[model samples]
Target: MKITTPRWALEAAGAIGAEMAGTIAATGVRVVGDTALLSAVPEAVEKVPAAPRIAPEVAAQALYGALAAVASAPVRHSAPAKARTVHQTSSKELVRVLGHRCLKRLRRR
Candidate 1:
């Protein structure tokens, strides 16, 4: 069994999220008067903090962790590869949703 990521896009997002966490007051900040921890209230997440920035090293490692997660996510493979809706695919399909810019860049690779 091998693990794989959803795609380059998702991993990039996760990395960004992790990087932002560091400056998120994380320990405490304006508004909420320094709770030191985000309570995960839907409104709080939506209203304040406005998101934060992280150290570049943290950002890269965060990206790495996302990549690792993609590499280690659980995948459910059906029994014996039988009776499934399978279709042949081309590399083009892989990058189609990636948008013209990304696809064009990958072409260079």
Candidate 2:
């Protein structure tokens, strides 16, 4: 017995394959089937010192302070809505009329 993959599955696989091939070519990486080979090992650079760790209590306090600051900030209401122009209104009406006409035609078919 033979099993066949669905057309959509094949299409999706093809798209993914194309994307992977493009990415590999763009990045100048060499690949043999599933395995990727590095052309050269990059030289190691001196690492920057990591930031000092904050105490749990200090971190908690800072988080609470930030939340409190945000909560206490005044809320600004948005400005009133602008009036619609004749062009905008007419376009909307036109779309509604066209949509109804299309629906009527479709139903009659």
Cα RMSD of all models vs. native, in order, equals 19.8, 20.5
Error of 2 at 27 (Å): 21
Give the TM-score (vs. native) of candidate 2. 0.27
RMSD of 2: 20.5
TM-score of each: 0.23, 0.27
Error of 2 at 48 (Å): 8.5
Q: After superposition, how far is residue 104 of candidate 2 from its true place, in Å?
A: 51
Error of 1 at 9 (Å): 32
Model 1 C-alpha lDDT per residue in residues 2-86, reported as the tens digit of each score: 3434445555655665555556756565554433233322221223433447778999777555544443443344444465434
lDDT of each: 0.47, 0.54
Top lDDT prediction, candidate number: 2
Task: Locate the minimum summed-lDDT window of 10 residues in model 1.
Answer: 38-47
Model 2 misplaced regions, further than 4 Å: 1-38, 43-53, 80-109
**How far is 94's C-alpha from truth in model 2 (Å)?**
37
* lDDT tens digits, residue span 1-109, model 2: 2355665666666666667667887887765665222222234345566675988899977855554454444433233226544454454444444555554564589
Q: Record all residue pairs in model 1 with backbone atoms less than 3 Å apart, i.e. clashing.
A: 27-36
How does residue 48 of candidate 1 score in lDDT?
44
